[model samples]
Target: MNHRHLGRSGLMVSEIAYGNWLTHGSQVEKEAALACVRAALEEGITTFDTADVYAATRAEEVLGEALAGERRAGLEICTKVYWPTGPGPNDRGLSRKHVFESIHGSLRRLRTDYVDLYQAHRYDYATPLEETMLAFADLVRQGKALYVGVSEWRAEQIEAAAPLARELKIPFVSNQPQYSMLWRVIEDQVIPASERAGLGQIVWSPIAQGVLTGKYRTGQPLPVGSRAAHEDGARFIAKFLTDDLLGRVQQLQPIAQEAGLTMAQLAIAWVLQNRSVSAAIVGATRPEQVRENVKAAGVKLDDGLMRRIDEVLGEAVVRDPARTASPEKRP
Candidate 1:
């Protein structure tokens, strides 16, 4: 519930950011989502992270509608632009046309003049970087966006955007990458790159999309109507949720037990232990989940606990998984 500066940018955001990924309109209904958002605000969470592709853009509209009931100045809103929205060739990417069109769509959906942060959801290999950055820069220039950021970008890609933003006088702020006990690729590349560029880091799914939550045990079926059970990308995750992964998760049970916290809480606290991590985005289907997640913010782990975590899952960390035959962007 505490506030933290987002990367090197001047804008301050809640350390615990509410993100709507697969939860909107699917696992969570509008009433429940609104309750969660309200609970987040009451818990001191001020930033909300959403994306253009989340639930096919319905998530932003849902979040916007939920937040609209409250005062507009009460929250720091963030939404990403990228991903194919329609069949047209120009439906996606960071092109000027897409950026302009996307924001208007997001604005109309969110019912706001501007979002606190507007992020390029991913690296647009086809769109010229200049066109993309300048378009984002113009958003800030016009006060339609308070800050610009990128998500799940490679080290070199972010490094390139930083200088370009500097020359254009764009206030590029942070990177939102998937960071959790199960995944540490960002540490191998993105962390050092971000530090060098003075960009703050905000990580998503610090619980590894609920893997670290310790809710699914070995041989137990995926919970009925869970996000992983419903979403398409989640089907890929289902394959990885094996007895082996569950066994590893169980290993950390003792570590979290010693800290008097749940595995999910311990995992999220671990992500925040790094000074470079400005915030960790956590989402929930209900208000109780919000309360459960917020407890991690109060549980400070020691070096011994960290080493124990590393020992339990050391084999999972790879130097560069992106170099493999299958390059996974974000999960």
Candidate 2:
């Protein structure tokens, strides 16, 4: 495993990190999630990422249960805030009041004293940036969090954060964004801004939520018990899983084959190929998935392979959220 400093924080993070997103409190059983966590650690992946909104917050509880006592000391646990938890008006966002309250719940759920990196899950237009930055600084001062970050924020948002952190003297170490072979939106804005702000990038869904993994091929019915099978929030995935795009993705399979790598490995390797990225976060429902995804760390994408992938994707298929409809209704 390779390591990189998390921006200016100077904390060395593995090039591949484990994230509990759709799988932790939804698809994978507790024993399986625990085993996957162990597998990541054994492979030298020290950072664990989770969000407060994942599976309605049960993901944190499961991770906490799995990493209780001295076992918890072996890893760096990271979690995020934002997204509504309930009916209360104050239930979410990056307000100082909420940031202070949310971390307490997160700490209680994670069964840990402090998070290695506590991120604002998204940009909170409602809260003042100063309030959020100051709240994060307080968390560090109180020893509730070691460092602070943001996720899925636009480039300008990262730029906006730097001055606030500098004014408050708080360390803004990283930003987690979605970047993959199929999705290069970060290259447009987020990547450059993070670089300017000295915020190390950690990309989530580096496989584009398994689309680039060659799992959802053209003309195939959605796989049973797969994320494509997720009826609740995967309708957007179905929209872009078009025959034309799958054909394009399949055309690039030879590139991975010629390079002696799996499509998943190739996709992840491409994301980490950027020196600006501190890590690429992988979501695994099974322990075996962790084993498979981690191999991407050192696969290395050469210029010829990159050009071939671009030849297949062309300009890359960009999506408009407005074009997608609601997810499949639960039975």
Candidate 3:
């Protein structure tokens, strides 16, 4: 897989990062999850992304076991905080106590001494920004995390934090957002703000939660065991399930055929076309799905093909910057 420098940092991550979000602990069996990680490694993927709250933190344990024998130096392991890992009030947000305590739990679960990057899963409205950055700063000083980033934060939120990160002298490198052919919320505001702040994007849901894969068709039942068929997965993907959107997604099949790419590959390559994107995160339930996504790593779609995609998916894209948001109150 091709690699890119995350933001202006010297650390390089595989362009196609293997992520275990909904699949590792909740959707797929442990053996299946491990097999997918092996497939990723076999395809030369060196970066893996997970979070402390995913599947109540079981995802990290699964990933830890999967990467147990590998040379840690060769892998870029990233995880996040800012979500409730327990029922206690202290269990959530980016308060000093939570951030400090969360990293230890993450480290223990991931089986790593220090993560290459530790990110805020979402902006913490409840905690003071200073307390949050200071906590991350301390982790860096203590050698528990090498770099820090935020996910799904607004442009103004990033702008607000940039100077604080600079003041603290921590390596603030990336913002993980959901960006796909169908989800373009980050393009107008977040990308420009991140560019100014020296933050690259590690985008998730590049295939629009599997909508852009062209598997969910108009006037058809949801695939037997597809993401849309699962209760929790269905909620995140519901917005892209309209007949109008599904019909537009279907029209891209010929474009994929012409480019000798699968619908999923086409979706991934389309996202990487944006220079601000450092990496695209892909999650899989099966090993072959991991293999299929890595093929898009170095593939580039020419201008003509890109235009065709825009034309076909016209008006179906969600570009309103207001959609890039975090909860007003911590959950």
Candidate 4:
């Protein structure tokens, strides 16, 4: 797999990162998850992304076990904070106490001394930004985390925190967001602001929650056992399953065929076409899916093809800058 530097920092990550967001501890069996991780490693993927809150924290443990004997120095393992990992009030948000407490729990679960990148899963409306940054700074000093980043944060929130992170001397390097052929919300403001602040994007859902895979045909029964059919994944992908959007997605079949790519590969390559995107995180239940996704790592799409994609996905694309947001109140 191809590797790229995350933001302006020297830390490099695989172009297609293997992430276990929904599959590891919840959807797929333990043995299946391990096989997928093995497939990723065999395909030369060195970057793995997970979060402490994923599958109520079992994803990290599964990943840790799957990667147990690998050469640690050669891999870039990243995880996030700022979701409710427990029932206690102190278990959520980015407050100093929570950040410190979360990292320790993450470390024990992941079986690592330090993570390559530690990210804020979302902007915490309930906590002061100073408290959050200070906590991250301490983690850097303590050598528990190498770099700091945020997920699903708006442009203004990133702009506001940039200087504070700089003042604290922490390597604020990346922003993880949901980006796909249909979701262009981050392109308008977030990308520009992140570029200005020296942060790169490690995008998730490059396939639009499997909708771009062309497996869900318009007016067809929700493909058996597909993400849309699963209880845990249905809600996130529900918005994109509209007939209009699905038809627009189907229009890309010819485009993918012409490009000698699967619809999934085409979708992934589309996101990597952006220079600001350092990596695309892909989750899978099966090993073949991991192999298929890694092929999009170094694939390049030309300007004309990109324009054609834009033309086909015309009104289905969501580019509203205001859509790049976090909850006003912490969940």
Candidate 5:
């Protein structure tokens, strides 16, 4: 796998990162999850991304067990904070107490002394920005976390925090956003602001929650085993299931065929086309899916193919900078 420096930082991560968001503990069985993790290793993927809140904290344990024997130095293990993992009020957000306490639990669960990157799952509107930044700064000083980043943060929010992170001497180097061919929300404002802040993007949902795979047809019923068929998974992918959007997604088949790539690989390659994107995270339930998605790591799309994608997607694309918003209250 080829590696790229995250933003302007010295850290290098695999171009295709293996992520376990909805798969490890919720969607797939334990054995299946481990098989997928093993597949990622076989494909030379060294970067793994998870979160404290995924599967109510079970995802970390599963990933930990799956990666138990690997050399820790060769892996870039990343997890996030700021989601409610418990019933208490302080259980969520990026307050000093939560950030400090969460890291210890994450370390225990991951079976690692230190994580390569710890991210804010979402911007905490309730906590003072200083408290959150200081908490992350302490993690770096204490050697619990090597680098810090934020996920789903807006352009203005990133701009606001960049100076403070620098002042605290924290290695705040990346942002994790939901970016895909159908979702261009980050292209306008967040990318430029992050470029200025020396933050590279570790984007999620590069295939738009499986929409770009061309499995969900325009007029067909939801595929039996697809994400939209599951109750919990359905909610996350609901926004893109409209008939009009499905029709536009279908138009990419010719492009994928001409490029000698699977629709899934085409979707993944589309996200990596942007230079500022350090890695695109892909979650899988089976090992073969991991093998297919990782093929896009070093693949480049020609100018004509990119323009064809733009033409086919047309008005179905979502590029509103205002869509890069955080919840006013923690869920």
Candidate 6:
């Protein structure tokens, strides 16, 4: 796998990262999940991204077990904070208490002394930004986290935090946003702001929750055992379930064929076309899915193919910068 520097940081991550978002503990069986992790390792995927909130934190444990025998130095494990992990008030957000406490839990579960990257799952409006940055700074100094990042944070929020991160000497290196052919919300503002702040994007949902994969066909019932068929997974994917979107997605079939790539690989390569994107995170329920998507790692789409994608997805794309929003309040 090709590696890229995460933002301006010296850290190098696999261009195709394995992420356990909805798959590990809840969607797929343990054996399948382990096989998928193994597949990623075999494919040279060095980075693994997860969150404290995913599958009630069981995903991290599953990933930890899968990577137990590997050389830790060769891996980049990333987990996030700022989601409610318990009933208590201190269980969530990017407050100093939660940030510190969450890192310990994450480390214990991941079976690693330190994560390569510790990200804020979402910007915490309730907590002071300084408190969050200071907590991250402390984690870096304490050797519990090597780098810091944020996910789905707006441009203004990133601009607000960059100076403080610099002041605190925290290595804020990445922004994990949802960027896909159908979702260009990050392109207009987040990318520009992050480029200025020296942050690269580790984008999730690059296939639009599997929409761009063309598996969800127009006028067809939800595919059996697909993400949309699963209750927990359906929530994030419902927005792209409409007939109109599926029709637009189908228009990419010719583009994928001309490029000699699968719809999934084409969608992934589309996101990596942006120089600001350091890596594209992919999750899999089966090992073969892991093998297929990684082909996009070093592949580049030509200008004509990219234009065809834009022409096919025109008007169906969501590009408004204002739509790159965070939660109004802590969940």
**lDDT of all predictions, in order shown?**
0.82, 0.82, 0.94, 0.94, 0.95, 0.93
Q: Write the per-residue lDDT of candidate 1 for residues 1-331, one digit (tens) a residue.
A: 6778888777888778889887876668889998998888888888899987888888988998888877778888999988888788788888999999999899888989999889988898777899998899888999999888988888888899989988999788899887777777788778888888878888997887787877778877778766567665486356347777778888889888889998778988998898888889998988998978887774578898798888888776434637311223332
Give the per-residue Cα lDDT of candidate 1 at 144. 96
How would you encode candidate 2's per-residue C-alpha lDDT over 98-185 as one tens digit per residue?
Answer: 8888899999999888998999988888888888899999998888988899987877778989998888887788998777777666
What local lDDT does model 3 show for residue 47?
94
Model 5 per-residue lDDT tens digits across residues 208-260:
99999999987789888788898778998999999999999888999999999
* Stronger candidate by lDDT (1 vs 6): 6
Model 2 residue 117 CA deviation in Å: 0.6
Q: Higher lDDT: candidate 4 or 6?
A: 4
lDDT string for model 3 (1-331, tens) is 8999998889899999999999989999999999999999999999999999999999999999999999999999999998899999999999999998999999999999999999999998888999999999999999999999999999999999999999999999999999999999999999999999999999999999999899999888999989999876999999999999999989999999999999999999999999999999999999999999999998989999999999998999999999996888744
Quality of model 6 by C-alpha lDDT: 0.93
lDDT of 3 at 18: 95
Q: Candidate 3 at 178: error in angstroms?
A: 0.3
User: Clashes in model 3: which pairs?
Assistant: none
Worst 10 residues of 4 by lDDT: 322-331
TM per candidate = 0.94, 0.93, 0.99, 0.99, 0.99, 0.98
Candidate 4 positional error at 113, Å: 0.4
Error of 5 at 28 (Å): 0.3
Kindly list the per-residue Cα lDDT of model 6 for residues 224-315, writing each as its tens digit.
Answer: 99999999989989988888889988988988999999999999998998999999999999999999999998898999889888888888
Candidate 4 clashing pairs?
Answer: none
